[model samples]
Target: MKKFTVLELLSLELKEHNDLDLKCIAGRKGLARKIEVPNVNRPGLALSGFFESFAYNRIQIFGRGEHAYLKKLEKEKKSENIKKIFTFDIPCAIFTHNLMPTKDFLDAAEEAGCAVLQTSLPSANFTARILRVLNDIFAAREVVHGVLIEVFGIGVLLTGESGVGKSETALELIERGHRLVADDAVEIRCVGGNYLMGMGANKMLGHHMEIRGLGIINITHLFGVGSIRDEKRIELVVNLEIWDSNKQYDRLGAQKKTKEILGVRLPCVDIPIKPGRNIPILIETAAMNERLKQLGVHSSREFNEQVMRWLESENVRNIYFHNNSI
Candidate 1:
């Protein structure tokens, strides 16, 4: 079930009272009810008496002073304004600081269809705590259009415009034994110490990908159970673009690329796609290369070093031969 937040439950308007716990009591709200706050500590104020004036349809009481004062206000038969304000159609009243509603307050609440509850926490503290909890629980959930797949045990998130062949490339990767995490729309969240995790949306879960002219085909169904993944930790990002012949590409692999999500940095690679270039093979190679780096092996750098050493050795030999001939 979806989570509910405390901020989502609070009443629209609030009236401050002397009891600090009263703020905590304000946190208790229902979709159908209102809350009544009594000014027990400050009986001298005319505005304080106005609470008994509203419709007490649903009320809950907390705190002993509020309980006792409500009875006194009822016995004295407060003014019409006070009656209108206090006689609210409230559903529940929460008592803070372990204060219990008086018998008179209970009787009035019962007659008015109000419920009362008590709380031990200070009002301000409770409200603050509940607000934070609600913020996390009630945050909106939406689908982010992107492709996410697990490559070489590293979660890679691919982002680009529509019809960029993201799904097709992902399908190829799946066929090559890489796991498909999500297609079309991936829902990503930051969890476990700032690491981004991704999963398929409920509607798109376990669904096959669609490539232009290729029609719809399921990855797991076509490639067996080894092809699909339930979830994956996003560790890298790959952005695909239409190949430009005039643009210079990084042939030396010296350029370090990364992307930031939710304040966490992820390794990134930009692969330009065009005719005759196997994008899937390149992606696989990139993934494997990343694994090698993690395991302390750098193929490109090592190969470059080997070539440099060979050139140096040949230069030394040529100089010796020239000296001997001279």
Candidate 2:
């Protein structure tokens, strides 16, 4: 990730609930200051001259309480502490609920080259939205050549070599009512160190797909808004390859295979492409099976267990019959 500055945060084209509604109030010179962490700190303690463990690196948040305290400090002519607060290299100061800072506080921030931002949202709401945005910006990401789609509510990443029919299969699935998350280049990110989130590498070209002879086609325009999604959690990975007559494939699905992306392991399946094979339906079935597994209903394991029980019963019946005949 490149340097994320206060200017970039202000320029983010967030919508609705995710909007920060932020604008520069003072210290415009420090808009290029890099934001190093995904966390924010309220400078209440630091403002009161308690500098023991001041987190000067994070973005400082000024809520109602903090704003009132600054007014009190200014009324008492105690501007020394206000100036001291900006001595450190703080990323920026954000005033929530459209609160304005005292003249002394703004002068101090401007003098020290620390950016001051104001938002119309309440402190709690702004905090939540900014945290969500920062987490995404700071997450570990990688770009892979594949197509991502949602089948039966499961997010599946279709991967393989070039021209192995990944995009074509996704097209078929989209035609069959599945939603396309991204086509061609999928940018996958590890969020919360637990799950993987995948989206289009470029937001401008997100829902566009390039078929062999069809060239570039917009999935949203052709299939409507219902057929496209901006992002999805990658729950399963399906690798499609040319049919190998000599290579063995998993016949029973008793052994589960996995693929690791950014330290997160996801369930993976290998599908060999050949004539007369319905790749789209196979992918749909795989997605459904994955959902069933998540519900603790593993089909392959249950089948193997039932087979073992039947063999044990047959052996016991044979032994009893032989003993009785003797």
lDDT of 2 by residue, 67-116 (tens): 99999998999988889889999999999999999999999989999899
- Give the TM-score of each candidate: 0.54, 0.97
Error of 1 at 268 (Å): 2.2
**Against the true structure, candidate 2 has what lDDT?**
0.94
| Model 2 lDDT-worst window of ten | 1-10
* Model 1 misplaced regions, further than 4 Å: 1-144, 192-194, 201-206, 214-224, 322-326
Residues 273-310 of candidate 1 have per-residue lDDT tens digits of 88898988888788778888879998878888999999
Q: How well does candidate 1 score on lDDT at residue 145? A: 79
Error of 1 at 97 (Å): 26
Model 1 clashes, total count: 40
Name the weakest run of 10 consecutive residues (lDDT summed) in model 1.
Answer: 35-44
Error of 2 at 213 (Å): 2.1
